[model samples]
Target: MSNVIFTSSATAKNGRDGHVKSDDGLIDLKLVNPANNQVAKGSNPEQLFAAAYSACFDGALNLVASQQHKKIDSETNAEVSFCKDPEDDGFKIAVTLNIEIQGVNPEDAQQLAEDAHQACPYSKATRGNIDVKLNPKAV
Candidate 1:
């Protein structure tokens, strides 16, 4: 905890059907449950998670490439899915990060992605709790 460099805080009212706002007041949005047949006026938790994960993964990819002394043009798309947990009859989430690196071979790109997955904070946090699949391709 002492080595923490940054922290983010947000408050959510109600369960998936109220409002969420960051401490900085930069993100204030209405929340909706996509499975409830509700018209989404703002955003959902899955969408928010996807955005955060994709951005974080992209940054991790850049850091890995820089460490390897390789110039990479990369894009990361995170797809987060909320589904029923068959084992416990509860709910669980899964992520698939579709990554593309320009001017790199498929194998190299995949390797970079694997390395980045080990480096990304999000990936590390969800390593054993949730399933994450990495799909990297050269573009």
Candidate 2:
């Protein structure tokens, strides 16, 4: 078998009490409870998923655009929602991606978005289990 590895470490601060450490024990990360706060701080599963999905989608879009020789300058936003499954008490996620790319035709932008959605790692991982919506706009 082949092996690939990375490391993450976390410490409790004002947000969450406990921290998580990776195998190699390098990078630090934490999970915080956003109970009274409006936004989630520290690190949580949803935040991690959101970060992963957003970055993956953006990378996928960039790959598609580069392959098609298109120039796009804008932002991509991904919102990932996680909730407990009522039946099994498991977690489920829902993602909504909004992409704004300037100087590209709407059709081409849409095509790139389609390709990105197909290529995104998080989308591929959560296929058929969660709801993922992609909205691409040309600005």
Which candidate gets the maximum TM-score versus the true structure?
1
Pairs of residues at least 3 apart in sequence or in different chains that clash in candidate 2:
9-27, 9-28, 9-29, 10-29
The sequence of per-residue lDDT tens digits that candidate 1 reaches over residues 8-75 is 99999996888999999999999988889566576889999999999999999999999998899999
lDDT of each: 0.93, 0.75
Model 2, span 43-123: residue lDDT tens: 665676677678878988888888889888757888877667887988677788999888798998898899888887677
Model 2 residue 87 CA deviation in Å: 4.7
Error of 2 at 135 (Å): 1.5
RMSD of 1: 1.0
Error of 1 at 72 (Å): 0.6
lDDT of 1: 0.93
Q: Best lDDT goes to which candidate? A: 1
Query: What TM-score quantifies how close candidate 2 is to the native fold?
Result: 0.73
